[model samples]
Target: MQRKLAAIIAGDVVGYSRLMAEDEAQTYSELRAALREIVEPAVQRHGGRTFKYTGDGFLTAFGSVNAALEAAIDIQRGFGTCPLDLRLGLNLGDVIEEDGDIFGDGVNVANRLQAMAEPGTIYASASVVRSADKEHVARFRRIGRRQAKNIPEAIEVYAMHPDKAAPNGLARLLPARRLSWSRPRPTVLASICAGILVTGFIAAGSWTERAAAPPAAGSTSGSLRATAADSRPTVAVLPFDDLSAEPSQTYFADGLTEDVIANLARNRELMVIARNSTFALGDQPADIREIGERLGAQYVVEGSARRAGDQLRVVAQLIDARSGTHLWSHSYDQRIEDVFAVQADLTARIVSSLVSYVRQSEAAAAVARPTADLRAYDLVLRARGHHKHGGADRAALLEARDLYGRAVELDPRYATARAYLGLTYISEQFGWPTADAAELVARGLAEAREAIRLEPDLPLAYQVLSFGLAASGEYEGSMRAAQRAVELNGSDPDSLMALAKAQLRFGAYDEAVENAERARRLHPLAPEYYAYIHGQALYAAGRLEEADEVLAECTLRAPQDPDCLKIRAAVLVGLERPDEARAAMTELLRREPDFSLAGEEVGRRFGNSPLMRRFLSDLSRAEAPPSAA
Candidate 1:
């Protein structure tokens, strides 16, 4: 019997049973060929040995974590063009080798991670990531803490996509450099690398510090920059040119651009630039490479929309920004009434080209039509335009609300319109001083529920419902709905932000910070509210400095936003900067004269939880105003 620490990899073929059932002989042959041609050579080249081969998968061991990861990545890349879909999981831990078989918690953990991984991807334990080479570390993105079946403690998981393009434009399947290897040593060095797994992973604070560090210079600010390490393809959609006979149809073109961006953003496999950032480029023509560099995007979507009377003609193209190649293009000519169908088709085709494997369910959800009534759809689009430009302007919000109301009346089955209408009411409660708060909350909740009833799968409806529930003091229900929204549309920034907000109110600060950070990454040009939510979560989690920095950005972005001011004051108080805290409170009071710690409104919103009590205590220390009553 022998015991030592080593890096272990567990792999399995996705849909192995179905493949074999369909063609047993062919499936067996392909599996054997993949093992012989791809897996064994990659393992041996990286100084690893394949210890065991299951009928449908294999287990490999390496003396070093780096070697194991390289082998796994190579194997996955090799299978990219093959019929088989492979998922790999890596772990660095102590294992027992007896009679040419390895056994222990280490092997169990690797198998669990393999099972959790998505098809054709790798999931590694935190210990594996921590021990990996810094260069290889860049290839990993933390998915979050996941509890594997029968695992005593949750394991923090990081994922890597093997098929993603390399930064140097070379294929990922390039042969790995051979490593000089002698006998595997069981020594202090191996123990040090395996220490984290023994200790049940690093503290949450440590993980956050690592993740929240500022991005390197020359990378895209506020975004998950697409580098050689992070291979998720980044895309930008510029505002479509309006070639309409009447210039008044420009809004239609802009609406099409926004819809395409929104749909593409829903696919987690691709990073879609926010509408604001891309649209800011306007209708200007420039070098595709330059636009890509500016947006940190590898692909660009450009199009033109022409509307003549009842006939609509739209032309769209997808360009490979790096090589200036037009990968795909399509022209659509349809009645004005079929514009929605055209938008759906355009979005689906773009997604098909960008993602290697597009889940039909997610693609369908992304292009789901809001309403069959053209008038209702047009009204909702106009309302969104007003909302986007309005910010906290009372007149603008009222105008949007009126338009959304008309849309709902025109097509009562329009879930998206009802959801947005509910959002406006909730916005009124926070930003409109003269608005009836209780009435708005009731109306918002009712509208949100109706939207959900109309379309249960609409992520936007669940997000709105979460806000309305939170406002109405249904904290648990609010959290549940927010979770459902994320589950339904994992890549939607709004859904993620809402979940973060709900998590914040429940004192799940770590999760709140994570989700909020994800939302910011997905939509780098996200509104000031994202900052507010993220900052508050950091503050609640006792990360005062990070909270202060994020809140400062929020204040700088929207100087007049009282929510930002309120959180900034709390963070400053925590940092022991009493004068700055008081200054923030003063500014907050200037903007919201009725702001008070002792008010029923504050109590209703924050409740009497320990976290909220601390928040109120901090506000009091900052000399915030007392209730008028």
Candidate 2:
């Protein structure tokens, strides 16, 4: 027998004997599949080898104790929805290796520990706990000293709880570093340092400092001039750094960043720069002032994410862009599923710090609960990212729709996912090829109605319902749903945008412009649709020059957007710019070869509205083709 120190891992399915007795063939097949698909891959990923398999259990060995613990955690998390419930145990000690098996006190202790672990949990011996990195150690929740059968000495044990507070040693280990990363104002500096230490990323030095303290004068005078001139307190949230030992968690970090951005965009009083612009900054060192100036943001939010076993820690800070001073900071240690709450908390704090006199209701809207099902929520977020990146990739939209479908399947009560699925269907219906638009709109309305029925209080459900209703020509219902959505979450950019569109279709020109402007303030980096609606609303109200200015910006921002081009053509015609009007119409026809005033859904929706009449007359004057006229 060869003896050496090793991390021994043992796992057993709960109620295995009973399950097999009840359905021998089915239970055996499910267990075998899980071991093959979930357990084996996790073991291999963490550098562990499964050396033995019991009828309903497995024994694995790893050179590093941390690897064994992590693999155990991964297995437990994966099995949360599996047919079998599993309890894992890990111990670090000298083990004897024989012909084809590992055996010793370590194996015995691991088995004993497994018997004590709760289902869906990993329990580790003191030696295993001590072997982990400090950051990993911070995730350990002590299970206390206990005596095990066949063991002479009492052993200390720990269980991984991702949602719990950090260990005491974490703060002691971190240095009292000053504002090298960036200065926080006096009021929040201490809290910021505390946040860094609590997140466990401080020891790894996962943050970067700018090369220069303040950006040079005139550095933002070029393209940034437009962004810089916006009067509202503009803000950007850079992508959070992923500090997880496993590379697979980078997506989780990205999702968290998106959630933060989404939350901030709910505040109608703040000008939140869109994720596309901030994410362009990437994970590199740059002057905050330069970032602020370039994005035309007055404030910046930056953060880092770390995951150890089942525990997750996120540290975030808000900084004043021009002064390089941090305004607020916090650390959240929670179960991975509670990430949405962390984002909500951080957004509310940042918004409060940047803007004064934020209404309690407005603040509440910024943190409205989306869903309680974490897995479903994750799928929805992933789908959102895919939808955003779908630009010309038809597959991306299909994949997003499938993901959203899966999310709702996992949790039938996940109203947010259902609502988003409604939106995805609408996008598929109207965008690109535009085939099956009518059929898709019918299906989308069903999804929207179902979402609203599932969670009547959810603002997003009503927002999507409004879009579906309007597309189906249920004008009265659409207007009512839009109004309800706005009343429920008046500060939400998406809610306001949806209401604005419904209002435009209803020919409530002044109200549409008001809502569109509110939406723009909430999302300064909004898509062309918001600007187009505002411009069209102005035109409907006979504010021709103002409409011209807005439509020009809309065309500049999204030259290819059919609606923007359509509005631009109308605005140019109203301004007596016949040449520009012709050019816009020509471009619009190129994108939509079948383009005609009579062929548009909007024209039908606003059939009796003056705006639609003027658009049709302008189409004739452009003289592109009889089809357009």
Candidate 3:
């Protein structure tokens, strides 16, 4: 085998195998037609020789990198009315010619890049784009880099957006993307119910949505582009194995897993991956490296739980996913009553091992007893589990609310349980069409404030208060409470998220971005609202391009989320993509026909900032029903 400089092209039919399985003869015919009528000719015209065909894909190489890319673009553009969608990858590197066959990292890298590309999209390595002609470079829009399968280092990737060619396409120097999180914005209704006077005061006219100077600190990188060193040491707690003989004990195991995640999440020093992402892995036996790469976690915590009679046995281990080294291991054989203590011990050990600057206050607060009543604690854990079970199901929310209320009833002094109860109430109210939006907010706010009154220092209480105050349209007050929570425990993603949301409202775009980024780094699998808030901040700051990217992802992650759709539509409007924005608005209206941002409630919620005024104007221009714009 002799190595020589070459330009590699990898092309594959999107969902070709699935298409073939459905209609073998028709798929085969279409595939052959594409290869014979379009693909082969394009390669030949570019002076590229087709080396091999692997069912749905083919490998080609050319002397000129620009020619290979031009071939890829032409082949993609060739599919005008054709139903078949193709993904192409181009890379410039040295390849090994072996016995009339081409092989090497160049070919592999091209394939990996192709696999990462969207259907009907062309992705190229940085080397390919840099070596190609200026004309070719002008067509590229750097989406971001990626950690491709089996690739030792991250590959800088660029997408060919020939359809949206602009004078300056994706030329902005952007930060690298990393895995972050997001959720939809909850509807905030101003309480005006007679006989129910709201006592909270909003610090109005104190803040404006003016673009602040960008801070020298904080990374602007997308979650997909962020490196591990850019943030904290992230960890994912995989679902614990159920070793119990009784089938009903599954809840206990799930509760234990959630408890561990919750306790670990309290220490802001460690970035704990959300349970949703970890639970999605299911029971499959995956490589540590794969888990790390997928979850962007440096460490993974896994264990098995069993209950025999009145005794409980749990074995847990923490491993470094990068090196596949066991960092710590522990086995506990304790009564069911000691489960909480065991969870605390495990969390403390993991934090101490992974982080060097665990504040003494946080460490002490981390293991602080929520309640001595084991039954109440168990109820709270089960309630939390129900709440965390995927989307906000009304039944689940009700069940969790009832359970949390019972937990608090059983242990009157349980501040954590009370705080969670309030949150569960808020979850129950989120988008509930039947309830009085204002009344629900009032109830949730009352519970949250009571939680704070019960235990003033409880971070969870303050976290809920942040949400409550924001729901009450007290953005400044909400931000202060959120900041207090962060100061108390800087590792809590919820606190950071709350702070970011408040900052966004008060028009502190840069600070909002910084906090949102930190929150996302903490829980890379954060709620869809996290992404929404970050995008809002970017949009308010006039960074329409970056905001478009974040909002696009938010919509993809949660298609039915109205907030994501609204922001995505707004971002599209900001970018002057009217048709796309209209399509997004159509989807939003279809989902939420009553969607209107110009309502009095919305106006009061989003204060009167120039950016808010602009957003309202944009929404109105997009045909969103205007209340009083």
Candidate 4:
């Protein structure tokens, strides 16, 4: 046996035993695939070798501590939306290697640390943290000292901050991959600990208080809004199948289905069928096309849920009911401490996925439909296609505004159309040169209020009102409106995004970043504006690298968007990349020839705040257009 200093990594699947119990062959195959595709590849990439496989876990050795920690981080991120959850631990100490396997206190300490880690997180010994590079060390926070099983002395541990693990360059810009893995069950202690942590993270500040309040007074009673001849695509969410070993778990499945239906109804874009209408068909499986024809739905959302001990597995799919084509599908496996918590999260994820797929499918269909057949809802849908592309396309923005106006004229009671019409005015106020800013702001505010009057529970109306208020310099009112939108529908990405933007304008940078991140998490396939807002929040909070990464994604998605280009240029300047910043500024100037540093537009948006100063300084450094100051 040779003793030498090495960085050791220990990783274990969180619920390996439960996975095997459910399906031994499939579990074994998935474990092998994970090791081969994710774990081993990451290890190799970071100059590590998997020295041993501990059945449901693995032990890896790296010559460098930084490499070991990086490898562990990469492996954890690689799991992404996959059902598998891994706990990783790293230690730097003397190890005994014999016959290509490691042993001794180093390996033992790593195993103990791995056992202590929460699911999808990394824990490292103080020695490892000390040996790591400064950049890597900064990403971890001390977790105090802990006594390891069979170890003589207490060891100091550090946990990596979840948000600090930045994706390399534009990697995070890509759509999340949908991968399947056998579900694992967490230990009782781990489950309770994770539950507490999740609760604390989610229930921070006033948001939880607002979330606990009852729905707004004028909320509808969960009925389908669209009629039989409604131009918008109609969606039906069927009751989820109970795939558990015991039939008693059907309640959980049914509750999840109901929650998903309710959440989808909050989105004004789609006409969601009421739970009663879909659940009336019973739990029997039917052909997608036949179900669509019977229910008069263009799309169908179907899924199954399984409960095993304290763990739950949910598999969902979005289908084009007309063609019986599966548009998207994903599976979620989570440890359940509170059934309602699991239901809420599962519902949000499912609804977000369904909305993205449905919108894409609808937009494609709308493009093919002739203009003569367009109705208020159809016009709004087509308008959204233009609106989401940002204000760089002058013709498109004008077209979207016109379409929204026509939509409102056709159906004055359509709160969704009016809200979007208000949003267009606000967008125009910021994006274009306007002679009567007060009139634009007034019109925007009026439309938003009218929409709210028409439908008080409509989160979109509240979101539009928040934007309009912000543009009118009513920060307090803007915040209240944004908060109300979130309180009404916390799962809606648009609501979260509106709140984030309001928070940013209100000088709550950290809160802005948190809300924007939450929005991105909910809607992985969200439009470019999501990235723009998230990057803006990060930039405001002085997180330059993260802001740079996110803004890069925003520019890639909408290359001509002036807001994205402006922010990207500022971030590049902050990062001290003068040439890149100059390049970005050149592109920005190409898009907006009248851009200027001392323009009233900047003051109108940012006021005299520190963020505005920083934004100006960065732009000035990038050599933006000359100011008339």
lDDT of 3 by residue, 257-341 (tens): 8778877765544556667667777477899877876777889999999988879999999999989999889999999888877
Using TM-score as the yardstick, the better of models 1 and 4 is 1
lDDT of 2 by residue, 288-388 (tens): 98788766677899989997766889999989998999887889999876766677678778866765544333454446566777778878877877876
TM-score of each: 0.66, 0.57, 0.61, 0.44
Model 2 reaches what TM-score against the true structure? 0.57
Residue 119, candidate 4: how far off, in angstroms? Answer: 26
- Candidate 4 runs further than 4 Å off: 1-411, 555-561, 600-605
Better of 1 and 3 by TM-score: 1
Clashes of 4: 2
Q: Which stretches of candidate 1 lie over 4 Å from their true place?
A: 1-230, 283-287, 359-366, 433-436, 600-607
- Candidate 1, 103-213: lDDT as tens digits: 888888999999877766788998999899998887676554566778897777777766444323124334333221222223322432342222122221111221222
Give the Cα error of residue 572 in candidate 3, in Å: 1.9
Q: Candidates 3 and 4: which is better by lDDT?
A: 3
Q: Judging by TM-score against the true structure, name the best candidate.
A: 1
Model 4: how far residue 82 lies from native, Å: 38
Candidate 2 regions off by >4 Å?
A: 1-236, 245-248, 264-286, 290-298, 344-372, 389-392, 432-436, 601-607
Clashing pairs in 4: 15-184, 15-185
